[model samples]
Target chain A: MNSKSKIIPWHSRFDLQGITFLFFLLLCLGSFPALEGSGRDLDYWNNLKGFALKLFPPDFSILRSTLQGIWETIQIASLSTLLASVFSLFLSLGAARTISPLWVVSITRMLLNIIRTIPSLLWAILAVVLVGSNPLAGIIALTFYSTGYLAKFFSEAFESADLKAQHALRGLGADQFQAFQYGLWPNLRPIIWSHCLWMFEYNVRSASIIGYVGAGGIGLHLKLYAESADSWNKFSLVLLCMLIIVTVLDLTGERVRKSIRDRLEGKSSLIKKGD
Target chain B: MRVKNLGICVEGKWLIRNLNFTVRQGEFLAVRGSSGSGKTTLLRVLSGSITPDEGTIEKENLNSNECAMIFQDLQLADGATAITNALSGCLGRNSFLSSFLGFTAQEKKQAIKLLNLLGLSDKLNQWTSTLSRGERQRLAIVRSLFSRPRILLADEPTSSLDEKWAKVSLELIKKDVEGRNGSVICSLHDSHQARDFSNRELFIDSNSPENWSIQDVESKKS
Candidate 1:
């Protein structure tokens, strides 16, 4: 028998699109009357257009305040990621199936999943309610969120390491933790560091928005400007600043990731050469 | 070392049953058989990687520090260099933190000394991925001996080697085991090689011995 010619089962019954169409039709019937009397005249763009028009020719005089807000946002993001990375490193060990007992792994993974279910914005709001409107609240919320996300990936990296090295180490009378230190960590270090660098970039943007929930940062200032009608020009100026800040963050993150990869793969560092 | 009433089963088929054996200090015991004659399986069971279905392995006067195994595949970590992999045998002696930070000066010196004896001193820092099959096989033996275990169990140590390398490997193995006051139990598909190094040999046939005896008795002309 030619392996390539092996016959598979040929019956193709239903498709997903048919089921999706029925579900969508039911939703249309249920919410049909709610969309009535809300025509093109009541569209979002028509209502938001006048306010948006007043936002152009941004006030450059607010540069100092916007720069201060950007610095505060960067500080919050960097500190949160640092704290979260540390927490995830320890939690991931308990969550790793090879290193941890079954019950411990189960409990840690469950707790992490629950933590992840609470979105960053919700955690920020909860932090504000408990700790008052401060950048500390945003930092705490983002740190917890990043910890939950990073721990999952870290455990997965630990689990995917070669079992032969582990087995050999175990045979040498090394304990579980010893085997992990020698056998798994060396293999997983680069991948884990790369993921952490990527997560730092993600947290930077998320930190910007947490301020909108009254946790003070760039978004807090943005919200204040939007609230006062006279300061609409400052809103555009702050938006432009945010764009520049985000772009710089993105470029810095890219360079950091490349540098890590280059070092791990034994490549010559281009930026290091330039410096 | 002695194995009493040793048996092995895989997927409901018995590979070996009621097989008893012993290996003594300073002895080279060869288990000779054709391919698929339960030779490797018996070696694995002896090595403690594969547990027999029924057996009691009693190591006479064996200390925890006196057992080492060289696998057929060499089992060296490909990501590490030859010296690094060899030094891993001393991992039991070092603290976990020291091993993770790489070998100490003493460990490195010991690894180099062993690799020098194995005629692999020049290849000490060569990555395992770049090693030839025979080089890897020798490295594997060196790795096992680096721990200075009393009993060295090798599964087809010379099977992948050329004639010259094969003889060199077997001679090194005998010399190392004898030097350490250790013993060796090796399985071989080639009886010639087994006869050269080992003082004693055991043969395993796949057919039923009882049925063979019965047929011989019935077919006698006398």
Candidate 2:
């Protein structure tokens, strides 16, 4: 407590984080090649203008085709997300500390980590070989991708839930499985739904791109149009369609998430009202 | 049930050692000690949360299901209502699947009845977190009883409660235990309250390892 006993004054110590951040900034600045003439880097702007001009005056003629592609993309994402959620439900339970023991959880975690590390594009490519170049391949790929992402979140949710309640349930003689059902799952329901909705939104975008590798859907069509010299209009149409799909999915996902959150909050409040 | 020669150590230093106690049906034992004394640890051992390094315990009459504990913090699920939380105590008897699907009507009714008896009928569906400290403690005690355990172990159940609630809670606990013909072993920081409530008292003096003396403290008013 004495000033004489103070080994290091708080203000005198050098913060390594600040020094490291400055070093990183200097490195980035050093690597930047000076532009000969800087008038808003014309390439990105040209692409944007070209895209806008070609896409706009709104092609109502191509609307039907674009809507079909968007529909197909959504179907792929929705089916894939549903399947992935089922897989994640079981896998996460195995991975969670509450349900599974150490070795089981660790091994399941390692397997999920390996699966997650492989990009969904690679999974699509592999699925194309196994299941042929079709929408099924895209679905399978997205399913695997979502499983890895969702399972990790699900397990964390399980562990972060009120452990005291779980302990009380276990102490009362509930088996591990029962403890999960009564104590853990109810608490995780809203969180899992939120993650699931987010995954669905992600899958919609992923589904569009997976077609680039010939896994079948709007991406394949977009690639076909983009490669053709005269079909820049079609390419523009596909991009517009993908954008619309993403926007719609994002909005709907947000709505669903908000609704679920509100319902859960209302339930909690009602429970409080009883008190 | 008997806990023989129980010892507890924390990081090579012993907190309590060679503790011996036997609890029988319908008997009430109040463990009284100073703040730093090992009353809570002894209760944990009695409740089967801690195992002794040196001694053996025997449960001659009661099954594992016949043991329940009320933690000092109450440990009630704040998100759950009183009836739901009380019903949780009976989770030991039901299968995991059944409990998860939610309790049956009969079970709910029984839990409601129990809560009603504890003067919590009005708050049966109220979240435990909204309950006052005294109410939460009472809820936990009721939950422990719902487990249908032959022996109930409570640790400082009335520590957070006011004098009236404390007296009421202890009376409820005593009456409930007697009605079931079950034993109760509780640790109390307030010696006067312990003397007033429990039929018998065990005073803990943890001066040195393996040197504790369980004096027969009088529970009667002086």
Evaluated on chain B only, what are the TM-scores of all the candidate structures, in order? 0.86, 0.88
Model 1, TM vs. native:
0.73
Candidate 1 local lDDT, residue B220: 29
Off by over 4 Å in 2: A1-23, A34-47, A61-68, A93-107, A158-162, A214-275, B3-7, B11-21, B54-56, B76-82, B117-136, B162-168, B208-219
Which candidate comes out best when scored by DockQ?
2
Candidate 1 ranges with C-alpha deviation above 4 Å: A1-12, A15-74, A93-106, A224-275, B30-35, B72-84, B95-102, B113-142, B156-174, B188-222
Docking class of 2: acceptable
TM-scores, all candidates, are 0.73, 0.79
Which lDDT tens digits does candidate 1 get at residues A1-275? 89877765544323587678778999999997887665646667766997787888899998998899888888888898889888998999899997799999999999999999999999899989989999999888898999999999988887776677656665655566766665555456667887887887788788778889977689898888888978888999999998987898789878877865654454522222100
Candidate 2 per-residue lDDT over residues B39-72, each given as its tens digit:
7887777767777666777878777777788898
Question: Where does the lowest 10-residue lDDT sum fall in candidate 1 chain A?
Answer: A266-275
Best by lDDT: 2
C-alpha RMSD of candidate 2: 4.9
Tell me the DockQ of each model, to 2 decimals. Answer: 0.12, 0.29
TM-score top scorer: 2
Q: How would you class the docking of model 1?
A: incorrect
Please give the range of 10 consecutive residues that has the lowest summed lDDT in model 2 chain B: B213-222
A146 Cα displacement, candidate 2 (Å): 1.5
